[model samples]
Target: MKQKDTGVMLLFVTTLTVIIWLWAAGQTKTEATVTTTVRFKAPEGMTSTVTPSFASVTLTLAGPRSAVNTAKAACANGLDLTVAETDGTVSINDIASRLNALDELKTSGATTVSAEPSAFNVDIQTMVQVEAAVEAVLSNVTVSGDVTVNPATVTLSIPKRIRATLPDAITVQAVVSDSALQQLSPGVVHTRDAAIRLPIPLDVPDVTVSPSRVEVTFKIQSMKEETVIPQVRIILAGPPEDYASYTVELPRKTISNVTVEGDIDIIDGIKSGEYAVFAVIRLASRDMEQLISSKPVTSFLAIGKDGAGHQLDVSVENPDALNVELNIAPVSGAE
Candidate 1:
């Protein structure tokens, strides 16, 4: 009797297992998500404020078999979130786009509103090592003394080594000519002659200081009263470079109110004749049918003033002489 009971129980268990397996055969389980992403905007301007700087965001997904499979490829493409656009001037649209793209990748589970990229932060405080160019003007400033530079405007790029030491804001040491040191203004005139100082922030690289410091040449400007050489003249009118028999002269001594505008330094130039009279020559075209047709020769100082108070390239020994092989257009005899 006991054996019969045991056999019957085993047959009942077998029947239950077969029934359960048969009922569940064809249905497919819903698919689950793999990943998800969070995207932020790329801000514009100064870049001082933009953070984290993430490019593509990822997301994990789960859903119906087809939807979950689709999520795999979509998530790979990444989410689009855009940085808010306030003013038309900024380039933060990338961020704005990325932020919006996240949703398309995977459906936000009805259970959770957030997407992937669990936690993120943008650090604006990472001591941005940057290089700044400082433009200094020597406007009314003058050299302290007799020093001179080839170009008044010093072009300098801060070296990476030195730039590494500079602060957010940079201040260059004052520049004063050694010769004119005594004549400088009561206060410190730290910068002069369009002198430029590069801001060498801490830990920068691959830069150079132009001229090291400005070249202190002999002299370029003066601070004395402006003086005019009453009889000194500029004689630069003659023939073109091709003309050999061109003769230029200021038959009458050349004198104009010597206008020294900058400072006494320029006045000194007037007295020294280092900056002497510049002569200009102009030839009007014989074709005066209209001022528009033949433009008058522009006023150019073909000859710069020299030390001897005369036109360029001419000396007292040689006098004013040039060979100008030129022919003026003959006057019109047309009807």
Candidate 2:
């Protein structure tokens, strides 16, 4: 009786297994088709002159349940379409081959995997990295002081293929807003990192700029004024080697009148004697004692006082030259 019971049990178990298998087969047949969208990208080093119309492809996958599941899982991360050739257009066959080659998709038992629109055209271009200059756009502001820029240029990753041809020069303009210009008052200085923007060409779509911004610095001074200082003494810059035996004299006791023109604030400071403004004649070291007699030499005015470390833009408006006499006799054999 025990042996008979065991045989019956075995038969029951086998019949149940066959029933489950049939049910699973029916389910697979009922839901064997799965469509998924896979994102495709162009190969590296290949860029688009014009953006691609489609960034993704709809793939209809149909096969056994197991295959569909595998394909779905594999495609969940999307597809990378790398082409050895850069013809701007990808064919359906090429895509199919790539999808079939994927181990996950291949093993998934998908009978067919196809893309919608099969193929499409893209204006393709090659990319090149180059260093480009940064130009400052200063409009509606008068620059009376010094202007400086840090990192006056930037590196650009640009596309340079026909339909994607690079211009002879690639430059980005850094604009100084009107608001910024409004802040330029006398003695006012401004420093800031201004963003650089690339002007879109007639048809170019994109450009990549590294260090897209740079530090721009400038000092703004009030409008200049002309001030005349009379009887300003003229001093020789470097004296002759035989100074003890030589004498120098300006035929004119002093500049009849030295006219300086610059920012009012700076000019006032100079006039107040807060800064030392001098008329000087710079002589070449080699010609120190060579002057046998008095000679006229051009003199320029320079500031000795540190006027906020700014070079005074003052110039002598009158008497562009000053004549001076150098009386020199070499001290006994000392040339």
In terms of TM-score, which candidate is strongest?
A: 2
Q: Please report, as a residue range, the 10-residue window in candidate 2 with the lowest summed lDDT.
A: 307-316
lDDT of 1 by residue, 1-335 (tens): 99999999999999998876754542233544444444444444432322444544333334444445555655565554445333223334233233334565435321222344444444332123333333332333434544434344433354333445556555443244445443445333233432344443422333444454543333334333333433434343433542232222233434333333334544455466456444344543322222221122123122225433322222222223222122333234432
TM-scores for all predictions: 0.24, 0.52
Please give the CA lDDT of all the candidate structures: 0.39, 0.61
Candidate 2 clashes between residue pairs 3 or more apart in a chain or in different chains: 67-108, 161-164, 294-325, 294-326
What are the per-residue Cα lDDT tens digits for candidate 2 across 1-335? 99999999999999999998976874483233344454445565555443363356666777667666677788777665554345445444445556677676777677445666566555455556677788776654446566776788888766654225556676787777767665567466778667787766522445677897888887654555557776666666565454655555555556656676665566777778776656566665544557645444444454646533334434454534455555544455544
- List where candidate 1 sits over 4 angstroms from the true fold: 1-29, 36-39, 43-49, 55-58, 83-103, 106-117, 124-335
lDDT of 1 at 211: 54
Q: In angstroms, how far off is 193's CA in candidate 1?
A: 24
